[model samples]
Target: MTIKSHSSRESRNPRDFNDPRNKPQERSERPERPERSEWASRRSDRPEGATRERTERSRPDWAVRTEQRRSPRERFEGGDRPRPPRGAGLLAELRELDRDLIKMIARRSRMLTRLPASGASDHERELRTSWEEHASAVSRDPKLIRQIFALLQEVEVAPADMEQPTAFNLAPMRKPVNVDLPAPASDRLPRVHMTLAASGASECVLHGVPLNNPVMECLKGLNQVGARLRWEEDGRILCQGGEPVSGYSKSILDKVVHVGDDPFNLFLILFQMVTRPARLKIIGESGLKFVDLAPLRHFLPLLGARLTSVVPGQEGLPARLESSAMLPSEVAVPADLPADAVEALLIAAAGWERPVTMALGEHPEGRSVASKMLPILRDAGIEATLTDAEGALSLHVVPGKAHFGVEPGTGINLSAAAALLALPALAGGSVKLRGAWDATGDDQTREGVRELFAAVGLDMRFSADCAAVSFGEGLGEDAELPPLKPLTDLSGLPSSLFPVGLVLALIPAVRAKGGDLPRLPQNTDMTLVESFLNQLGLSCEDGRLVSIAPASTPWASPSFPWALALSLAAFLRPNIKLVNPGIVTNHLPWYWNAYNSLPTPSLARKSAEEEAAPAPSRPARRRVLASHTPESEMPDEIVYPDED
Candidate 1:
C-alpha cells in the first residue's frame, strides 16, 4: 500500500538480508582454516594443557636443534675434524733440538781425536778448556736431560748395525824366544854403561841400543843437551829429570840410529826411568868413544842452562860441563813417535824450558848428528837456530825469547823425518833454506817439502833448486828459530837420505797443486806409506808409482778412517801405480801381499777386419725439385728412403 512514498525503504525489510552489497565477502586478508580430518580438528579443539603436551611431543627440543644444526661456512671449515693433542708441535721441535745437540758433541769428539801430539798453545789450551766447560754444561742442561731419555728410547726402537765379528775361536800362536841370536864375536867392542836423568825416563836406558855409529853420535848430542845421564854398571845407564828436548834437533837425533828403526822402542826404556838425579855424570871405559859432545853446545841453552867449555889452557877441544837447573814450571813432552831411534830421544826431550842446542859445522860430526836430531827437536817444541856461519842449530833456552834465524840457501836434510820434524817448527817460525835436494838430486823432494809446508798452513817458498822459510812471530815465544830437518833414511850421506821423507811428506802438497816430486828410490821401504794409506782407509798396489781411477768412493771402514777422503786417494795412489813407503819396516806383513796383488792381462788373438774397420764408402745423392706436389699429382715418388 502507499508504494509510491516508501519506495526505497520498502526494499530494506527483513527479507532483504541477502542483499548483494551487504552479503559477507570471501576473506581476502584473514587466513583460511586448513582442511583437516575430523581427528585433527578435534585435536586442535583440545584443552590448553593437553594441546601444549601434544605440541611438546611433536616438536623437537631447542637444545637438540641447536646441537644438530651448523652454519654452511662452519661445516665447510671442518668444524667436525679432529685436532692434534696439545703441545705436539713443541715436542717435535724439542726432538730436532736434541738431535742437533748430539751431533755437536760427536763433532767435538772427532776434533779431539785429531789433536796434535805436541802440547797445545796457550790459545789452543784456553779454547779446549772452554770447549770442555761448554760440553759439561750441555750435558747438564735440563732439555738435554730430557733429550737423553728420548734418545735412549729411539735407540731402543732402532738399533745400529754393527758389522764387527763377535765370536773368536782362533788359536793363539806360541813362538820361541831368542830364535835368532847373533854369535858373540871376540873382536866386538865392550858394552859401556851410561846413566841419564830427566823428567821422563828417556834418559835412563836405550833399548835395542844401536852399535856406536854416526847415528848414535847424533843421538848422544841430543841426550847430552836434554837430560842428565851417567854411566852405571856395564852396559847400563842411569837418568834423571831434565829439560824436554826440541823437535828442531830431530835430524841429529835420527842420525843416532839406522833408518826404518822404531825410535819409540829405543826410547821407551829411557821414558820409563823415574829417578831424578841432582848431579849425574858418566864414568865408563868407552863412555867417550861413541860420545860426541858437540850437540851439548846447542842442548844446554835450551834447558835454561849454559855449557861452559873448561879449557885447560886450551890444549885441544875443551872439556864441557853441560848442566842446568830445572825451573818450577813443567814442560810438555810431545807424544809423536820419532821417525828413527835418534829422533825419538830428541823428540822426547824437546819440551824443556832450556832445550839443548847443537852447532852444526863446528865438530866434524855435528852436521851428521844435527840431521838425525832435527826431526825429534822440531817435534819436541824446541827452537833450533841454525847459525849461518857454523851450520849449527842452537837449542835456545830462552823459550819466550828464542828466535830461529836461517840463511837463504841453507843445505839442510829434508827427509820425511826431517820434514815432519821441521813442519812444527817451520809452521811457527821464519826460515831461509838453500841447496835442498833429494838423495837422488831431484827437485821433487824439495817441492814436496814446500807442499807440506803449505798443507800445514806454514809460510814457505821453494824454487827449482832452492827454498826459503820464515817463522811467524806467533809461533810460540822463540818463533824466530830455525827448525830441525831429520833424516828419514841414513843408508848413505845426508845428500842421499834427506829427500826421502821430504818427498813423501810433500805428496799431498804436490797433489794440491803445490808442486811435484821425483820418483823415489826403488829399494826405499814403503811401510810408512802403507801405514798412512791404512790410516786413510785405502790400500796400495803396484810399486811406489801408480795412478788412481776417479770414481772410487766406497764407504771406508772405521778401522781405516781418514780425515780427508781425497787426501787418502791422492797420497795412497800418489801418481798411478807409484807407491812409496818412506823408510820401510821388516815387520810390515802387508808388503808381500800388496806386491803380489798387482793386475795382469790375458793374451788373446784379434781379427784383422775388426782391427782395421776405419774406412767406408759414401753414398751419392741426386738433387730433387723443391715443389709441394700432392701424391695424386706426382707421377712417381719414393715415400721412404733406405738407409745404406
Candidate 2:
C-alpha cells in the first residue's frame, strides 16, 4: 500500500467499478420490479418461517383477510331485487273496491225496501240461513256470521223511508205513584210448591195468592208438572197433589216450559226437574234469554245432571237439561258461585227429602241466602240444620214429620217494596205501604228500620203497628240534608235496597276519589252493573257513579226490577227517556198505573205545607197513645215530618 501511495481518489477511480461500497445495494437499483408471482417464488431472501409474520406485519389485520371487491350500488341493494309497486296507485284501487262494495250493499238494501214486509222477512231469513251455511262450509264461526248478517238486515229493513220515519212514542207518565206494597210472594211460593210436591194425595187451598205474572207463570208450571191446579170460589187457589209432582215432566206442556224472566221461577222449576230422571228444554224471552247460565254447569254435575246452552257459541237460553236421577248425599259448593245459584241448589235439596249435606265455601253472602232459605224450608216442615265448623258453612237438610202453614206476612215482597220506598224516602217524600208486617221477623222491627235510615243521615219513624214508614218528608224544602254516608257493608241489606245503597255510596266514591266499589259478597259483575247505571243517567267511571244527568237516548231495561229502578232514578233526575214501558207489565201488571199514581214532589210539598199550616185560632191537636204518652207535645209552629 506504501509503494502505491498516490492520492486515494486517484487510486480508487479505476477500481471503483469492482468496489462493494461503490454500487447501489437496493432492489430498486435494477430497472423495474418483477411480477408478484415471481417475487413470491423468490422466498430465499426471507428467513425460513418469517415470511408469514413479516407479511402480516407489513399489511394491517383487516387487509390480511381476502375479500371480493363490490361496487356501491351492489353493496346497498343486497343483491338483485324486484322494483316496488307504486303506493298511490294501489291505495286508489283499494278505495275503488271499497266504494263498489258499499254501492252493492246500498242497492241490495233498496231492493229489500221495495219488497213487501212478509216477503222481506222470508227473504232475510233465507239470507241468514245461507250466511250461516256458507260460514260453516268455510270453517268460520257460524254464529258470528249470523250476527253480522242479522245486523245488516236490521239496519236495512227497519223504517224503509229514512226521511219520513214512522213515529213511535212511549206513553209518558204525569207523576209517580205512592202505593202500599204487600210482603214478597217469594217467601210463600216455596211453601206452596213444597206442599204440592211433597204431600201424597193431599188437597190444599191457597188464598190471597198474588196473581202477579211470575206467580201465575209458576202456577202454570206446577199445574203442567202434574199438580191439579184450579181457581176456587172466593178467589182462592186449590191445588190437589196426585202422585209426586216434582220428579219429572208429567204432561206434554211440561217438556218445554217458559219460565219468563223470573230467576226464582226458573231455579225452582229447574231444581224440581233435578230430583228425577227427566229432560226439559227450557226457554225464555227478553232479559232471561240473555242470562249466562255457565256457573250452573259447575254445580249440576254433583246432582247427576247436565245443562247445555242450545244456542251455538252462546251461554244463555234456550237450554236443555238431562238428569240421571242419582244425587250425591254430600256436595261441596265453591265460594265463587252466585247467591241465586246457591239458593236454587238448596231448594232442590229440600225437595229431595233425603238427608243431604251441603258444604258452602267461604262465601258470606251465599251463607246468608242459605240461612234465610233454611227458615223457609223449616216453615215447609223440612228439618234444616245450618252450622259453622272451622270457618266453613254447612247445611244438613232432612224431611220432617211436622208440616207448617204459610205465615201472614208471606204475601208481601219487603225486598222490592223497601227498594221502591227508598226512592221516595231519599227524595224527602212519604210512602204509605200497607203490607202485612211479619210478627216474627226483624224487618218490621222499628228500631232496625230506624237504624238503617239513620245510617244514611235520615231520621225515620216506624209506627208501633209497623204499618207505615215516615222519614225525610219536607226535607227537600229549606232543610239541607247531610251528605249521604257511604255504606261499606251491604251484605245484610235487603236485596232491593242494595242497589239504592250502591248508588248512594258510589256517588261520593267517584266524585271524591276514583276507585272500584267495595267488593260485593255476591261477586256480581260490577262492570255490567256500572255500565247499566251510566246508561240510566248516572255517569259512571272507574267503577263508581260520578254524576247524575239526564239520559241522552232511550234505553231498554233488561228486567222489570231494573225498569222500576230506572223509572225511580229518572224521577230523581228528570228528562231520561226509557223505551219499552210495557215490559214491566210482565211482572207488575198495574206497574204503570201505580207508578204514575205518586204525587209530584211539588204537589207533595204543597200538601205537606197545607197540613203543616195550623188553624188560625185553634192549636194543633195531637193524638196520644195511652201506652206511650209523651210529657211534651211538638210545637205547632215547628212542622213535623209527614206520617200516615
Candidate 3:
C-alpha cells in the first residue's frame, strides 16, 4: 500500500544514507526556561558576576548566627536537658542513711574506746541487746549487726589498750604427744531423750549421751519446763516426764531457753511447746540466730500454739511460743517442711493425749531424716504408719506408752567425725573413730564418712569396737599416693558435713591446679565458704576450681569446719597459722586437746631427718702380735706348696 514512499523519501533528503556532507535543518518551535525565583538567586549586595556561595558568605546572617550561640548552662536552664531517673530521690535518701549509719558506728567505736575497761562483760551484754533491738527496729539482720560490732571490738582504740580480744593459736601444740581421741557419743542421744521427755513418756535411762555444753543447755531448758533430767556419774541421763507449766506467771528468765545454735534442740523445744501448754522464750546462738522459722510459725497455729518473734520484724529466735490446751487431732503438715522438722513433729505427736493423724503430702526418700526416725519411733512403742494415698503420703501416729527399752546403740557424732577424719591425712598419724554405726539402723552418715576418706585414697578399717582411719597400703608417703579421685556425687553427704567435705575436696583441686569439684548443693548458702576460699587465693564458681596462687595466711573464723580446714592446711604449707582455734569448742569441746596431742608435721620431718643422719664413729681395735708370730714361724715350709 505504500510502494511510492522510498522514492519520495530519497527526493526529500537528496543525499545517500552514508554521505558524510549531509546536514539537517534546525526546528524553531522549542520554548526557553523561565527566570529563577528570588530564593534561588544570589544576594543583591554582591557584584553581578560573583558566584551565589561568595554572595552568601558576605551576607549579614553570619553575624546574627554568631550572636545567637548559647552556653550549655543556658540550654539546661531553658529545659533542654534530659529527664532525671525514676528513683533518683529515693536512691539519694538511701545513700544519706548509709552514711549516717557508718558515722554512728564510728562514734560508737570512739565512745567504747573512751570507756573504762572495768565491767566489760556488762557493757558487752548491754551493747549486744541494744544493737539487736536496733537491728530489729530498722528491719536488718541481727547476725549482720552482731558481726559488725564484733569487728569493731577487734579494732584497737589506742595502742595502750591492754585488754585485746583473745586470739587462740595452735602453735603451742606443734610438738605434741600421741593423740588418742575419746570415743564420740551419739548426737541422736540428746534428741532421743528430749523427744521422749516431751512426749510425756515415763522416766527412762539413756546411756552414752555426752554431757556437752549444747546437751547440758538442752537438759537445763527441759528442766526449767518441769521435765526431770539429771546426768548421773555413770554417764546415764535419767529423764522423768512432768507436766510443763503454761501462762505468763513464770519469770521471763525462767521461760527463756538458750538453744546454743542447734536447730535440733530448737525443734525439740518447739515440740514440747505443742505437746503441752507451755509459754517459752527460745533463743539461738551462732548461725541459728538467722534461721527463719516462718514455716513453723504458720504450722504451729494448727496445733493450738502461737509462735511469735520476740523482735518485731525478725522471724527466728529469740522468739516466744504460747500454746492453748486444745490440741487438733487431724493436722495437715506442709509438704516442703524440712525432713528434720518433720521428725521433730512426729516425736512430739507421740505425747499428744489423743491420736493425731498427720497428712504428710509426700513420701520421703530412704536418706531422709523422717525415714530413719520412723523406725526409732516404732521401736519406742509409738504406732506410726507412713502411707500413700493418690501420691499424697500421710502419717497416722497413735499415741502409746513409750519407753527406752534397750540402750540406744552408740553412734559417732557427725560433726566430730567429719573434723576428726581429716586429722590422719594432715598430721601423718592414724585416728580411731568410735561409734560409727547408728543403733537406729541409719548408717548414711557413716557411709559419708567412709567416702570422704576414700576420695583421698585413704583406708578406713571398721571393727566391732571402732573405725580406724589410716594411710592405704603402700601409700604411707604423700608422694606415693595416687591422684585424688574427683568426688562429683555428693548425695551421700549431708549439707551439715559439707564444710569439711568441701575443704577436703579443694585439697586435690588446688594441688592439681585444675580438676573437677563437688557441685555445690542448690540449697546451701556458701557465703562463708566462698569468702574463706577467696582468702586462700582460689576461686570456685559453678563447681569449677580456678587456682590463683594460694597464699599461706593466718586463718581465723568462728566456723569450726573452716578453722579445722585451715589448721589442716598446715600440712600443705607449714606456715599457715590457725587463729581462734578455740572455735572448735562449738562442735568438739576437746578438739584442741585431741588435735594438740597429735604429732606435728614439722616434728615428724625432724624425726625423719634424724633417722637419715649418719651414726657416730666407733674406735678401731689393734690385732694381737702373738697370732702373727706363729704364722711367720710356719711360713718357710708353707710357702713351698704349689698348685697342681
Candidate 4:
C-alpha cells in the first residue's frame, strides 16, 4: 500500500476512488468491514471432532496426539497466517501498520543518533516533519506509538477505518497525567583560576588531582620550570612555586618532555611563555584513560607551540606534543576542542603581553567548561566578550593580572556521586551531598547522569548547594528492582563516570541471574576497578562475570562511588578509613564532607595486604620514584598496544 504525502493526498485523481480497493470507504460502510470475516464459516463447515476422528482412524494414534499438543494461538494463526476472506482489507491494514511502524522506528532512531553529533540538516528536519504528520494521522493522543503497536498485534482494528463502535478489541487505557519538571541548565561554572595577585613568586595550587598520575605529573612539569611542590599529610597540596622556567636544558632536547601522568592542561600556559624555541611532550604512560587531547594539537600551535602525533586514538591515550617559542595571539577555535584545553588557554592568556581572540564555529553556550569560563574571566578583570555573527562565536579576551594562592573548588560528579549516595542509600533514607555548587555545576555531566537514572525508577533534583533525591514512583519494600534498560547511546554519560555507573547497574543483573561479570569499559579504567574490587575481597574474577552471592549486593565493584556505595548498601561500619581515599578527593575538594554527610562511614574497607604491610621505609616517599626523575631517570618502558 502506498502512503501519500500529507499535502497532496486531497488532490489525487477522482478515478482512483472508483475501484474502492485503492481508496478507503466512507464511515457508513464500517459495519460491513467486520461482517466480512469468513473464518467462522470455515470452522463451522467441518463436523465437530470429525476431522480429528477421521485423521486418527486413517493415520497412526501418535498423529492425533501431536495435533492435541499444539497451542491455541498457534493452531488458529499458523506460523504463517493465511489471508482473511472478504477482500482481506483488515489483513492489508495490519501488514501496512507493521511496515510503517518498522520503517519509522529505524529512521527515527538513526536520525536521533545523528542529530546530536551534527546540527540538524534539511533531511533531518524533513524526516521529523514527516514522522510527526504520520503520527498525527494515526492518533491525536500522546499514546499513539503504543496504539500503533496494538493495532499491528490485532489488539485493536485500524482506528482510521473503524466505522462501528466495537471495531476495537483493545480496552480504553486510563493513564495518569505526569507533569514534567523544568530541565536543568547545562553549564556548571566550576573553573580553576589563578590570581597572579598572590605574589610575584608565581605560586598556585590546582584543584583537579585526577587519580595520582596527573598530580605527580603536574609537580614534575612545574618543578622543571622552577617550582617546589609538596603533598601535605592532610591531603592538601602545598606548592612554594618559584619563577617559571625560561628555557629547556640542552640534555632535554631531541627527547620527549615525559610529563608523566600530569594533566596536559599544564602545557597550555607553560608552553605559551617560552622566550625561545623549545621541545615539549605530554605523555599518559602512567594512565591510559583521559578526555580527548587532540584538540590541543590544534589549539597550542596557535600559541606559538606546534604539536605532533596525538598518539591516542579515539580509545587510547598518552598524546605527544611539540612546542615552539613564538606565541599566536589570535586564532579561530578548532571544530572540536577539549574543555580543559579551552580553559587552559583562557587562564594562560592572562600572562600574555597582548589581548587574545579565540573564535568558534558555533556557540558552545553552557555545553562546555570553556564557555562558562568566559564570565568568570570577565569578573576577574580579564576583558571578555562573546560575539555572534551568522551564528558563529568569537570570544575576545583581554589580558589581566594573574593571581596565585587561589582555590578552585569542587564540581561533584553527579553520576558518580548519585550512584554513590542515592542508589544505595534508598533503604536508609535521604542521602545528602552538601557543598556542591549547583549554579556552576557541570551541566553536561549532570544532565547525562540524570537522563540515564530517570529511565530505571531513579529521580534526582537540584537545589542550592546540593541535590535532593528520591526513588521513582511505584517502588517499595519487597518490590523487585526495575528491569535493566538497554543503553543504545553512551554519549550522554561521561566516560569518567562509566565505571561507577557499571557498578550500580550490574547489581540487578546479579540478583536476577545469580552473577554477571561483564567487561568493564576498558577505556575508562574498568580493569583498574576490577583489581580494586578483588582486593576488597568481593567474589569477582578477572576476565569473568561478577557474582553476587553470600553477602553480595547484587553488583559490587572496586570503582570510585560504587565501592563507596556498596559499603553503605550491604555493609555498615561506624568508623572506617579507605586505603586510597584520594580517588574521591581528586575530583572533589570537599570529599570528606561529602562522605561524612552520608549516614554512615562503611566505605572504609582496605585490602588485607594494605592493612598488614609494613610502613614505608622512608620518612617521605614520592609516588613517582626519584630514579625516574629527569636527573637520573630510568629508560622508557613504553607499553606496546599488543601487550597483554
Top candidate by lDDT? 3
Off by over 4 Å in 3: 1-182, 232-234, 240-254, 286-288, 363-367, 388-391, 422-431, 436-442, 451-457, 461-464, 474-479, 541-544, 549-558, 599-644
lDDT of 4 at 14: 65
Report the Cα lDDT for residue 382, model 3: 78
lDDT score, candidate 1: 0.35
TM-score of every model? Answer: 0.21, 0.59, 0.64, 0.45
Off by over 4 Å in 2: 1-202, 231-235, 247-254, 362-364, 400-402, 406-411, 436-452, 461-469, 473-495, 502-538, 541-549, 600-644
Please give, for residues 94-122, the per-residue lDDT of candidate 2 as tens digits.
99999998777777776867777777647
Ranking by lDDT: 3, 2, 4, 1
Question: Each model's RMSD to truth, in Å?
Answer: 29.7, 23.4, 22.7, 24.1
Clashing residue pair totals per candidate (backbone < 3 A): 119, 9, 1, 16
How accurate locally is residue 431 in candidate 3, as Cα lDDT from 0 to 100? 63
Output the better candidate (2/3) by TM-score: 3
Between prediction 1 and prediction 2, which has the larger lDDT?
Answer: 2
Q: What C-alpha lDDT does candidate 2 achieve relative to the native structure?
A: 0.59
For candidate 4, give the lDDT of residue 402.
41
Best by TM-score: 3
* Residues 390-480 of candidate 3: C-alpha lDDT, one tens digit per residue: 7666677887656667655545676566666666554445666555354524556666777777877677786666777764333334433
